[model samples]
Target: MTTIKGELLEGETETGMAAAAQGGQYGAAAERASEAKRALRLAVASSMVSKVCSIGLQAVSIPLFARVLDTDDFSAMMVYFGVTAWLSLVAIGIWPTVTSIAADDRRRGQLAGVLTVSWVGLSAIFASLIVLVLVLRPVLEQSGINLFSARHYSLFTAALVCYAMLTVLSVGEAVNQGQHRQHVNNLITAAGSILNVVFILLVTYFRPPGEEHVDVTLLFVASQAGFILIRVVNMIGVVVRAGWPHAFPGKAFARELARNSWSLLQAQLAVVFLQQGAVLLCYETDMPRDAALLALLFRANLLLHSFVYMINQPLWPIIHRNMLAGDWQWVIRIYRKLATCYVAYGLLAIIGAAFVGGAAVSLWTAGEYPISNKLATLCAVYFALLVTSAASTPVLMGAKAFVSLGNIGMAEFLAAGVLCTILYFADAVSFPHVVEALIAANAMTALWMMPTQAIVRLSRGSLDAQH
Candidate 1:
């Protein structure tokens, strides 16, 4: 650990230590500050490697998808992902809530208590979800909501079931994050990306022009098997490292987790609505091409954001730990630096979007799909607004300001929903119009409101610490 601190600190800015000293009452907790930095460095490094691997895999897989798959197939893929993203809502923020609780518990040597509660809660939720999916299957089928045609519905169902299992099992990931072992989770992610590339390669080789050389269902099964393998492996590692929960936690602790999860659920639901819901909206409005285009754009934006989030995500646990130690001053200083980086990245992304987004899309899709500069610029602006709000997300989450975050998310969701409804009634629900509504909604919440709320929460936390 000392060697790691020396190596990481050698490359780290002097600002953190300097800021710690300047933070007035850093207390005895100040001594552990270097350890936090070490953990954060590992998290960032692992995330970077994982993301870079994903980018490389995508560089190979996306063009194959664009060229090899029919429009229906491609659209089906997007819908599959969009629907799975919605599955996140089922957790109702339990995952992050558990992660936050686990971080606090680790400091107090009560990690087993939190883990046991999370396992019981998530397992029950998963079982309920299975029942829900089975019950809804017939209803949705009979409802005639044919996004992917009758033939592909079975494949879609299978894939979604696999993803549902993956989501529930992701408590393992939350466990690792709280323990500062994000590298293991990250490596598992890289392995998943590798599996994705292999799946794409199989598709490319077997699903050649005018002939189906491989059973598509078999490929799907293979992919799901790979996902289950990696996730289960990660889960086993987490249990070995953290140990099984010694005992089920008290009902009060469970209830508190539920309360926090409910608050965060609102935010998570809004996020899903803004992102995946938009793609589904395009499809429902009878705009298949628009749906495909928007999905592609969102995919591009997400790829860029993932790199930024690699740095941002490590902050959740680190800040939560510091906040528990009453190191509010250090938290505030770190946030200021993070906010600066967000602004800089947002500007550069906008510039890049204006100058090269369309060209980049065309190149990425091997000229299969071309986008306009206007659309590209709008996408960039939307992404900038979204990322800006995210600047304070970790800080707010760490501060346990769930209600404030939830309210902003609810506002943003309502704004987007109302505006989309208005556009639909006005017979003006075009691609650009939907994107514009999203931008407006995000501008209202993310651009200023979220950051302001974060500052307020930080101030309150600082005051409490001093008292």
Candidate 2:
């Protein structure tokens, strides 16, 4: 009896020691994790500051352009900008899809082939889109009544090509971010914005005045050329720092990328449709002046949204890496913190915009056409939704909740369509009314979809992690 009791006591002692050692290791890991989170938070804050500065530059320039240029010129330039944005959607192809794949590949030292294939695939898509745009030029020329002249259209096409190339080059930056090179990505984007501003100033100075002045198309082309150069330089730097892969894309790797990239591509396409499609829809249905006004409101909202995105974008890879490691608890905690921060930031932005945006608009436009109270309200609500929705996006994406993301897109589309249709048929739709409808649709979607999808995915992911 004494021998047996002594043996049992020894076993308990050994188990206790093992547990204590494990506890010490866990405590160390937690400390490290906390430190990493602090570092990431600082990075996110820095990125947001940069985004604000970039957005401010854009906002300041708009009023200057508005002052120097006529409404018709501005309207035509908007169409040109819209077309370029649309073309970029097509040209981007599968590069964004490659981000997670490239990250995973890099972990295994297999990223070269994947990166090569992504580049080649995107380049091919860009070429195809250029050809299609050329073929559709006649159709585009008849798209709006305030269409640009042949010279402008040709210049716009050149801008689109340059924009497409820059977008492709930006994939390298994305890959860099995925590999935890956030500082590099931020620096490159900031530098590009700076260069773009310089080019814009030079173009504005040289351009003719009044109706013949302000060649929007040429300015866009020059800006894009500068942007593309910057991105190419940045991409080269990433390659130099990260070191290129040893092999080109293999057949099996290409197949894997295609399969893995489909969901990301679909998600991206859905987003493009949700955001840009709203502007396009407004342009198609509303008068040119109304479309321009709504565009201005959208741009104002986008400034806040862009800030939210900068806050969230750098955190995506971190969330993805944790999820890939099957760390559901950490995922939940991080997501909760991020969601709270986003909501807080969004609320602050809304309040600030409500109070200060009008004054800023007046100052910028020199009271040329003041932003109305209704428009200000619409901008605030729209920005709130944009920020919150963007904040919740990483959660959905991390959980592979592509279906939920798609449904959110569909809901927004249906809501926007119904609202616009109703407003149109009722003939009750002024610019403010249209803007309100857009904000309502966005808020409705975010309110209904984000929480529901997040909860479901979090629950499922948690269970899966346990298994």
Candidate 3:
């Protein structure tokens, strides 16, 4: 009986040891998950703060510019800025391709090679285009309304080129982000924002308010130069920290990058057309005060959108990395958390804008232009739609469903563009009516696209797959 009891007791002891080991494993996993959540939350908070400050600075500057310059001057500046904005899409082609490619563990080196070559190619193209446009300025001026002088147009074109270079550097930032280098990326962005603020302050002080006091054209040129210098410095820092190779592209790597980039390029182009195309359409339509009104509304809308962008920006690389690794469960969790935060913040913003935007506008302009109820309401609605769109965009991006997103954007643009074009030519709707059309188009696109993309992502089991 003693021998039998000894063997039985030994078996029980072994069983207890196994159970303890299992419990420890579970505890470690839970702790790891908790840490990931905390890190993501911190990243999101940092992004939001940075974007808010940047957008707020721009918002403040607009009123100052309006006060210092006359309506015609402001409108002319808007046209010049619009041209540069459209060209930016062309100049920054294929850089975002680096983001998704770098996310793949097997392809990071090749992705880096592709990024190097693509950047050179795109930069050359942008430079050539800028030169061509500059050379043809006389013909361009004579053929149209010529909102700005040759000098101003040239400066705008230069700004666009510089912005393109910034876009290339942004790819490095994206790569760092994919590698979970959030802190480094945040530091660079924060520094860039500080530099921009300093530049803006200097511009304001040196330029001062008056028709004869400052050269608006020169101000923009100097600002663009400053922007480009800051971006170059930031890019150098990212490359140094990431140990990215400064080498030419490999043949296989270049091919792979091109393949991945096609979809992204399509999506980006569609977005460019959808957003900047509106400005072009407004210009073409010839509705009275259409450019000025659109610029004002767009500036306000962009500020709100920037806030949403800040919240979502950091998530992009994280999502890309996880999705590439087939970690769907984590992706879903992150998406849900981000969506909840965005919705809450969006609600607060809507309320604040509805209650105070009018008063703020009036004070900023010193009653030079009273905020109409219609304008205020339109701005609020636009911002609300932007928030909803922001909340859904990340899920779509993570699913590699950019093709569908591009299609949806194209459809929205076509619908709104057609309606606006008809109204402008027919003299049916006024400037406000065009704004209403745009708002309705954007909202409609979000309503259809967001749900569809979410369902597709869930159905593919892409959100829950493990790496």
Candidate 4:
């Protein structure tokens, strides 16, 4: 009887220990969840404020530019902005890769290496930009692209150089973000927006009210300088406070970053197509009228998309942190909430835009650009898909599923381009048809990407737990 009792007691003790271990894990997970939730809230709130300021400034500047600059100068300025946007992404996958690796390094108390890597990567990218500018400027000027107009080519080149300088320095923001402080970047951006407004106001104040006027070069240079100063200060603060380590990271770490960046570049290029492809399609199809409408519609959609992007910007680091923790359940939970919120917001924005968007556009443009309901709706659907894909980005990026993203994105763009081409040749092309093709193409991408990621992540998490 005593032997049996002793055996029973041993069994009970083992059960109790197991329960305690499980409970300890649950407690730790709950704590992590709480921390993540708080971080996201703060990030979103800051991003919201930043985005509001940006959107407001943009609203102010657009009409201000339209009113002040002549049609040619205004068009040239818009093209200049577009070119700079592409230039800003010249670092491409480097940003995300650095951000993710930086997060991992921080968790392991080894951020110094990643920080050095980021600077090295930025330096290389800056050199490449300089080379490209020198090599491409002559070719582009000879080609007579609208952006390189003889009148403003020199100014544009100077402005681009300034912009490139600032862009390289902006890597600071990526590193800070990985440290779970995206608000630093948001603050920098908000300040830059305010400065841009000031520059615009100055331009408006000094305007000649005719064809000859203050070109965008001064404004661009001023804004870029302001951004650079703010970012440099922030970078210094971050590095100094983090206590820069003396140890140098090995080449393997750099190689790892390079490999990841290459994969990410593919994905980033795919995104560029989705964002800019509509305007190109309109131009190619010879639908100038539709092109104008598409431009307006895209701008309107972009404003709404900006809000989504703002939220996701901060959420990205949080996702990376949880991903590093091997907390798949937490990631999924957050993802579901995020995806649902995005879809709901997209649906509501589409519905709201369908109602007030036309009137709003009319008022904003002072009745210059009138949007039709059909065109507005199609644009909304396309951007909704775009933003949804964007929402899934941090997750795929966290998983380092860059190759899959590239493949799907490539296929999506190709399909859209082919379908649009067929319609154009068949003489059935319209802005609406082009948008519809985009919708179909992106839908395939989203359908494949999101589900597959979830399954793979869940499986991986399960295996991890079992081990």
Assess the local accuracy of residue 89 in candidate 3 as a C-alpha lDDT between 0 and 100. Answer: 56
Query: Model-by-model lDDT, in order?
Result: 0.76, 0.66, 0.62, 0.68
Judging by TM-score against the true structure, name the best candidate. Answer: 1
- After best superposition, candidate 4 residue 173: deviation in angstroms? 1.5
- Residue pairs of candidate 1 with colliding backbone atoms: none
Alpha-carbon lDDT of model 4: 0.68
Weakest 10 consecutive residues of candidate 4 by summed lDDT: 74-83
Instruction: Kindly list the per-residue Cα lDDT of model 2 for residues 22-100, writing each as its tens digit.
Output: 7876786576467447647766766766685577568656776676667766655655565555655553434434556
Write one digit per residue (lDDT tens) for candidate 3, span 1-467: 99899989988998999899878856755664565455567776777666665665565556666666565556656656555455545533354456666656676666555656656776787678767877887887676654435545655565566566666556666666555555556655656656666675677677645645345665555445545666677667656654566565567655655554565555566556655565556665564256666666666666667666655655665666555545566667766776677677667766776778778667655565567655676667766766765766877776656666667767677777777777768876555677677777777776568766866685577534522
**Candidate 1 local lDDT, 270-384, one digit each (tens):** 8788877778888877777778877887778788898677877777788888887878888898888888888888888889988898898888888888887777888888888
Tens digit per residue, CA lDDT, model 4, 82-129: 455466566666577667756765434456655665677667876776
Per-candidate TM equals: 0.88, 0.84, 0.82, 0.85
Report model 2's TM-score to 2 decimal places: 0.84
Pairs with backbone N, CA or C atoms under 3 Å apart (clashes), candidate 3: 325-467, 328-463, 328-464
Between prediction 2 and prediction 4, the one with superior lDDT is 4
Instruction: Please identify which of the two predictions, 1 or 4, would achieve the higher TM-score against the true structure.
Output: 1
